[model samples]
Target chain A: MATHRFDPNFTDNVINSMGPKTSPRLRQLMTGLIKHVHDFARENELTVDEWMAGVKLLNWAGQMSDDKRNEGQLVCDVIGLESLVDEITFTLADEAKDAPTATAILGPFFRADTPYRENGADIVVTKPKDGEMAFMHGRVMDFETKTPLVGATVEVWQASTNGLYEQQDENQVEFNLRGKFKTDADGRYYFYCLRPTPYPVPDDGPAGRMLQLMDRHPFRPAHIHIIATHDGYRPLTTQIFDRKDKYLDNDSVFAVKDSLVVDFVERKDDPQAGLELNYDVKLVADAK
Target chain B: MATHRFDPNFTDNVINSMGPKTSPRLRQLMTGLIKHVHDFARENELTVDEWMAGVKLLNWAGQMSDDKRNEGQLVCDVIGLESLVDEITFTLADEAKDAPTATAILGPFFRADTPYRENGADIVVTKPKDGEMAFMHGRVMDFETKTPLVGATVEVWQASTNGLYEQQDENQVEFNLRGKFKTDADGRYYFYCLRPTPYPVPDDGPAGRMLQLMDRHPFRPAHIHIIATHDGYRPLTTQIFDRKDKYLDNDSVFAVKDSLVVDFVERKDDPQAGLELNYDVKLVADAK
Candidate 1:
């Protein structure tokens, strides 16, 4: 009942409005959210114009979002919220030295129904003239037992040299640079595709405008998106970065993990030169 | 640069990522936001499922929003952030005894082309069969001078007895229960319309689903929405609640202020009985 003083932080009033059927967990979450948000507005002494600007930005994000795009999620990514949640939710405890590979954002570009392919197959349906193919191979293993995870499904996708995911660039064929492979008996999976390139998060919308206002570049590091999964093990969605990419340290999405960065070795005069990248992934067993 | 320990609260890392050209005000605002949002997720020990649920909820809100509706804003309103911002931004310093009338949310229903009618014209184009007419009049005044603002604009709109605005209900005549009037020489404006009714906020979308999860009712109280404006004084957009409405204390939007509540006197068998509801508005002069 905050009255007279115009103290709209009637936190109790709002909390009290909850009905008896409300979930205790939701109550706790809503309580914390209301307190922090109220404090944010009050401490900032946020003006009408500023508040409305935030509202309009969110509205713009909603308007710009659709099947092939998610401006709302992009807002979270650029603000570091998505990465924070990923870290908090998926990061293993420090007590475990043999943790699984680090998790990364399942960015907006991921699409379902990826074509399945055999080992050492190429995912680039039609490689660009300017693109150079890279050899990518890895072993998926069980973390605690240090054994190979036979028959694990490994899905991979990457941007073309132009930095646009296939779905975003109409000129590219559907499912270009995207595929899934079942690991061999030794837990090995391999594929050939154009190397991932640093790219901007879509900036034609409100979230992109935020980067513009921050004077921050929207480029994510050159990284291959991967998902390794097998029954009885936790599915890991992650990105492995080319260590040499300029955006590694300051990824627009704040999603880079030290353990997830690997060198795309260079062998100038050899056939395999600048063409090979080996990344082994470990999976944490799902608690029985 | 939080690393190894999975301390994603990399507050400085994200803050430092801002470009040198970022506005100082935006930097401060973002720093506060990042800290608060991160603390919220971390303190709650947020899980992947829970975080994803939030992301999905926001996505649903964005997808459900368009020209006729703004689910993102509804999310803010149901959470009380909009009201808190309005209070903090518009509430004058404690020393100003003659402060302007309290402000309220310019809810999603406001339309730009409100018909300009003479002082006593009725806004109800075609009255509902079950509706009872209410006579509403208001005066606009300068707070400090306590003088009438002749020719001030008084715009009013309210929900019909069925709890639907014109645009939301196709069956209703256009501009029903909405009109704008210029004050008479005495700063008086009047219009007849159906009495306001308590109504639920749009609950089919994510914001409404949130209220359902909280076991909270989505209804706002019976009230008349008004905006008083003149050449020099600050415009006051506010709501005057009917003292007898049950939802007055638990308004879904957290917008009911003590200073803005009024009793809608009920008239006996007499023609003029229970019909008179007069409210006066005060506006602070815009600072030079």
Candidate 2:
């Protein structure tokens, strides 16, 4: 009998080791993935037949993808890999520096170019009675100074009064319910657009099949998108969902941060305002 | 800026406040699994979409399962999870304790009922000309006593001549090339079976698709399966693959152990032996 030490890479003994040298980051990621994947297999006593089935599904997912839609990316997001990455990114930030406003999955619908507009300009985008007219005004200010940061760009978009994205609606005008506005000297900016309504994501693709399997709905609450940016301030790509939305708490993307949920107030018979809405503005500097 | 402690489980924030409440073994395993899974999720920046996709894949894997076929298990084997468990299981014994022959993947095609035969019986299983007959003989000795152990059952199976498993081949007879042999008083046993041929796994399924995606081929070398057991002996489930097989260094399941490879020698014109092929075997007992 011979004394022996356990070899960690026992599998490499028979299979000629030919893997490329991996960077620290990739090694860490692959190691972690392999361990968990291995554990999952052991816990389930996964069989060969079952494994092949997974391969087939992944292949199908790849085949389902096209230029217009990335089913693979959608699948990756649904599996919580995207959120996991976001969380890791947040963790890697310096403790002294607060993270930027929470980032969410850009659900494969954001367009590249949005028309810019002047401050206080009406970005009504379209004329539709399905959505209520709301005036949104906000200011970008230095967090410490409490002073508005003038000349900041605020790009905004929202689902129509019917709560469906313009891209999903062939009848809706292109870029309807979406526009860009710049802040005035006082760092104030206002826009006119119908309030967004809750709507379901496309349920006809492979992602839909996944949702059906989990018995989960694919609805997102009414929300107004905003991409605020200035020279010094960190670009804030965020959205504020209507607190009154039916799916406010159960947002499909898990993007509903507590601070990002806002109540839509109603004001009637305001002769001076000349509208049934009172808009308010607030600004804070980026946390250091 | 405020100083913050680098606390683990920040989001869940569920510290193990109740200390020492569980067995150390269970606690270690649970903690290890949690950390591994969480780290994997973190490293992958796994999005909600990806998470859902994984979950959906799992659910679909379950849906595609049947009593006779388990693709999940096969995946586990291919990824070497089962082999890892087996290594942990057998390596617990001290080095002075003889190690049993290495165990490999049982694969998804094995069955329980194989014909039991006397010592030196022929288990040609298929047509005589389908594959070359090999007269295999081996001794099961108690390493401590250096004595042969008789009355031990040796189970064996292999792929047919056409590189296809009985489970995968509708044309092959049930339990083809499968049998169990008991050792004679001399601790030697021999049986005739068709030589195995390298075969590809089911390529039409998800597992096949995964291989395609990764640009990997699915091929397992020709091998003879064996599980030898006797009273007070640790059971051994191992396989002896032909050394000349093309897939020897590239087994898909990572089941090929260095010590498990054996050569099949050609013996021509041996009138006394009346055999054309021969091979030797060595096995260590399982320490109690």
Each prediction's interface RMSD?
1.6, 8.7
lDDT of candidate 2 over A1-288, digit per residue (tens): 112344446433322222344344434443555556665544543443344444455445555554335565565444444444445554554245544455444555566787887665555555665457766776766644568878888788777666566776777878777777778898878766666788776667656665554446777788777777787565656677787789875665555666677776774573222333232233335444
- CA lDDT of each candidate? 0.82, 0.60
TM-score for chain B considered on its own, for each of the candidates? 0.93, 0.83
Q: Estimate each model's TM-score.
A: 0.94, 0.56
Q: Write the per-residue lDDT of candidate 1 for residues A115-170, one digit (tens) a residue.
A: 88989777888678787777888899998787998999999999988889888998
Among these predicted structures, which one has the highest lDDT?
A: 1
Please give, for residues B1-288, the per-residue lDDT of candidate 1 as tens digits.
433355744767887888999999998888788777877877776666787688778877777777778788899889887887777777643235555687888888888888888877878886777777888877888888879989999989998888889889987899888988999999888877767789999999988999999998899999888988899877888888988899988899999999899877664674632576888888788775
Give the per-residue Cα lDDT of candidate 1 at B175.
87
DockQ (CA atoms), all models: 0.70, 0.10
Off by over 4 Å in 1: A1-9, A92-98, A267-274, B1-9, B92-97, B266-274
Candidate 2, residue B2: Cα displacement in angstroms equals 17
Worst 10 residues of 1 chain B by lDDT: B91-100
